[model samples]
Target chain A: MSLNFCFLGAGNLATHLSKSLKEKGFNIIQVYSKTNKSAKTLADVLNSDYTTSPAKITINADVYFVALKDAVFDEVLSKINLENKLVVHCSGSLPVSVLSAYSDKTGVFYPLQTFSKQRDVDFHKIPVFVEANSEEIQNKLIQIAEKISDSVTVLESAKRKYLHIAAVFACNFVNHFYTISAEILKTKDIPFEVLQPLILETALKVQEIEPEKAQTGPAVRFDENIISDHLNEIKDLKNYAELYNSISKSIFEHHQNLK
Target chain B: MSLNFCFLGAGNLATHLSKSLKEKGFNIIQVYSKTNKSAKTLADVLNSDYTTSPAKITINADVYFVALKDAVFDEVLSKINLENKLVVHCSGSLPVSVLSAYSDKTGVFYPLQTFSKQRDVDFHKIPVFVEANSEEIQNKLIQIAEKISDSVTVLESAKRKYLHIAAVFACNFVNHFYTISAEILKTKDIPFEVLQPLILETALKVQEIEPEKAQTGPAVRFDENIISDHLNEIKDLKNYAELYNSISKSIFEHHQNLK
Candidate 1:
């Protein structure tokens, strides 16, 4: 029989991950959340029992998956007892040590992709990074990860933290630029759809070419005329102008070092 | 007969645009660049004559496509005389007046996509923005643009400049973030490939959802603890930390405004 799993937290990441696991034939036996609505919503989708109270969390499951916010790990985990069952937290930044105090068999199962509750992602393509306190638990976690992902690696907490930071730069910060682009286009009465092709192409280019060699625009060329013009246009918007100047200077310096 | 074209720059954009037009059955009659290697290289591919001297540019082509650098437009355009022939420039930031002095009929034919000569792009899907001095030239430019692209819009110079700025943020600066991500990953002995899925998903997410609504990360939540930890970790890198703080503050303020 497939291993029984219990989920702690039912946010975007938990919802997507639990549904994906269920689709792969694993049994998600229960879900626990601080909020009843979120718990019940995701639990209903998985056909699993759910409780808003941490003390009511099921203890018989073979594995426990904690997907809470980093800030609440202690308060949430302290209330539940898993009794040495394999426990995994799906976080990009938090270390496995956060779960070690609560269970002897603890590990991390982090999928390196952004998740939205409304969107469905192919887990087979997402890289899942795993880490555990013992080899047995590590292998057990890897087996589960390999079921869902084509690429699974045993990453330590040290390297995982940097990976998380790099993700912030690549995904979170990059999305902010998209937001800025949308705001700029909005001022001109242009639809954001016009930028979709360029944005997609830009990301696609880096897949084949090194990002350093793939770089373009006034900053790379250090074209002061166009750069100054762009700055002047957005100078009224203090934060944007500052970001434009800072990134431009960074790009110029980076290229200069390349030469 | 198809239109005869003379390309006045042999850079990435010129090579791609000229080759795309040739593939569509247009006749590329000549190629010109300040450097003979660039001129001859693209000319050899197109089976066209080439010249390094601006004075030697062919004046008899039906359309003169000038794709030179923005700063050198005056110095280059002043050297070629197109008489009453249609002159079109492929620049995002330049005004239509830049080509007006060289021909009685001048227009702008800017493709809103990034280009690299090593990669082939499907121009049929790329949006082509056109502007001209008159309705006759505008319609003529739009017809040519439509032949290559499914989406063609006649936008004024005033609005095109803003579009260009948005592209810089979306394509140029966004690529810079990719570079930074690679650098951060390198320090930890991690390949940049690990971030590719996240990077691509971030771009793809904006296609179906508004960027403001799609935004995620510690910044949007204003998670002080995680933000401070990340800042401390990258404090040694002056520029990266500055950018981290700046963009985080911007994201925080932006989401706060929505509330």
Candidate 2:
């Protein structure tokens, strides 16, 4: 029989995961949030029971997923009794061990993608990283993940932590660079759309070429004139200027060493 | 009468531009490169005259496009007399003044996109930033630019320089981050392909939403624990670890100030 799932949060990840799972014919038995409105909103879509209080969570559900923020994971987990049932947390950085005391079947169900409430992600393309304490649990987790995603991997906590960090660099930090670039254009009255094509192509290139081989720009070329000119342009924006100098220096040094 | 074009370089930009112009029915009269073989390769494709000598550039062509690197622009322009014909350089940072002494009618025909020999970019979607010394020259340049691309803008050299700098940040520097992330993943035997969906989606999100609003990850939320943990993961790679801390701190501070 298919295991019934209970979501312990109704934030972006929880909503996206629950909706995708529901579409795949998984039974989402309950949806829990700190606020009733948020829980009810997703529960209606999942056709599941809703609750704001942990005490109201359905113990009968075979699996429970805590998808809350990292800071609240401990406090939230402390309130729920897993009764040796399968429990997992949908966090990228958090270790699977966080749920070990509550259930022997504790594991991780991290979907490695930037989730936005407004955007509907195609889970088929998203890589779901599953981790568990035992082989049986790991196999079961991978099976469930495969239902929603074409790419699923069993990652250990140590490697998963590094993967999450690597993601922060690739996704989060890269987006911040976009934010900085947009700010630069705004000062000159140039629309952000001008940078959109370049941004898209840059990412697309990496798919075919290795990032080290694909690297370009003033930094890689060690073009001091262009770098100096760029520094002059951002002199007033001290922090951003420092960032440009630092990153450029690092890239230059990296390539210099490679040569 | 349709403008007859002469290309001064047979590199990525020259090849792409000439091909697109040729397809759009522009007469490519000549193709010049630093070497005869390189010149012949593109010239045969465009069905234009090929030459390695700048002195051999066809004077009959309406406009001459100096598409070489900025380092060679001065040297190449010095070698040839444009014969008071319309001349332009396809450089982002170089000002229109670089061509002013070369010809009475000088302008800039910078296509604002990274050009790679391996990639075929759609000029129709690429924005061509046009600038010239006079209204007549500007109008002619705009007409030629419009033949291939739907998006064309008249930007002064001053604004164009900043735009180029911004491109370096958005495209070049952003690609470097991908390099760094890929490096981190390689240490753990994780394939860079795993991060492809996240990278593409991160860029996709900014299309509809402002980047400042679209920013995600532990840094934006200021999760110091994860930040510290990431720093730990990169402890051996000093430069990358420093970059991680700096960018994360910047994003954290940027969001903190906004709040």
Candidate 3:
């Protein structure tokens, strides 16, 4: 029989994960959220019941997946009575120990990709990191994770934190550069779409070459003339200039150390 | 009839553009570089004659493409006698006027995409930015550019400079984040490939949504606990810490302004 899942949140991550699980033949039995609209919205899509209160969460499901914000994990989990039912939280930074008080069969099921409600990601391509307190639970979680994703690994909490940090640099910080690029182009009345191909290629290049080997531009070459020219052009934008200087210095120093 | 071309500085940009033009049925008649090996390497691929000496560049070709380093533009252009032939430099930051001293039909044929010799990019999708001294030259360049690229724009030198700066932020600086991400993951003995999906998706997200709206992570949310935890974890790495704080503040300020 397919293991039934009761989701404890209906945010971007929960909405996507639950929908993906449902599509993969697992039963998303119930949805729970602090807000009625979000809970109902996702539940309606999954054809599952939903409740805005954590105390009202169904105990019939074999597995409970907590997808709450990092801050409310404690408060939300405290109210639920899982009766030692298997539980997992989909968080990159948070540890499995966070769920130890709530259930003995606790694990982590972190899908290492950015999730937006509007965006539909191919879960099969996403790297899902799973960890549990016991081998039985770990295997059980991995079995389910493998069904939805082709790349599933058992990553411990100690290393998982670093993975999350690495993701911040790769995704969040990289996207910040995209935002900065758009702002710079806006000043010249140029559309952000022009930078899209360059942006996509930059990401694509690293897949083939190591990021260190793939480094280009003034900073990597330490071309002071062009670097100074760019600095002067964006000097009015204090934050961007600072970033340009700092990141350029970092790239230069990184290469220097490499030598 | 196809226009004959002579390429100067057989570097990444020159090699890719020349090969792309050759594939599109344009005749590459000659290749010139400071190093004989570099010149002959590209020349052999195109089945064209090559010369290391700038003066030895063939004047038989209707178009002379200057893809030399920014610092060597004047030194090399002074040596090559293009006379009244159309001379176009493929540079992002350099102004079109830089070629005016060399020839009356000078123009800029800047492709707004990152190029590496090892990587084969789809030229048809790459946006090519063109600029020239006259409307006639501009039209001629645009026609040639259109044959190679579907998206061709006639942008002036002033606006093109900003576009180059934007590319730096979008490609060069963004690539630095990938390097940093790899370094962070190295500490935990985690493979860089784990972050590949996240990096690619981050770039992909901007294509479907505005980067400002697509932004995620602790920085955008001002999640103090997770931010502080991450800062403490990477505090030993002074430069990474500084970048984390700086970029986080920028993201915070940016979103704050939007409200």
- Fraction of native contacts under 8 Å reproduced by each candidate: 0.81, 0.80, 0.84
Error of 3 at A192 (Å): 1.3
Which residue ranges in model 2 land beyond 4 Å of their true spot? Answer: B35-37
Listed for every candidate in order, the interface RMSD values in angstroms are 0.7, 1.0, 0.8
Q: lDDT score, residue B6, model 2?
A: 86
DockQ of 2: 0.79
In terms of lDDT, which candidate is stronger, 1 or 2?
A: 1
lDDT of 1 by residue, B1-259 (tens): 3789999899988998898889889999999999999999999999999999888888879998988888887777788777889999987878899776778899999999988766788988899999999999999888888888999999998889889889998999999999998998898999999989899999999989998888888899787887888888888874898899999999999999999
Residue A240 lDDT (model 1): 90
Work out the TM-score per prediction. 0.98, 0.95, 0.97
Per-residue accuracy of model 3 over A20-57 as CA lDDT, tens digit each: 99999999989999999999999999999999987888
- Give per-model CA RMSD: 1.3, 1.8, 1.5
Better of 1 and 3 by lDDT: 3
> Candidates' DockQ values?
0.85, 0.79, 0.84
Which candidate has the highest TM-score of all? 1
Q: Considering the two chains of model 3, state its CAPRI-style docking category.
A: high
Q: Per-residue lDDT for B61 in model 3?
A: 90
Candidate 1 regions with alpha-carbon error over 4 angstroms: none
Ranking by lDDT: 3, 1, 2
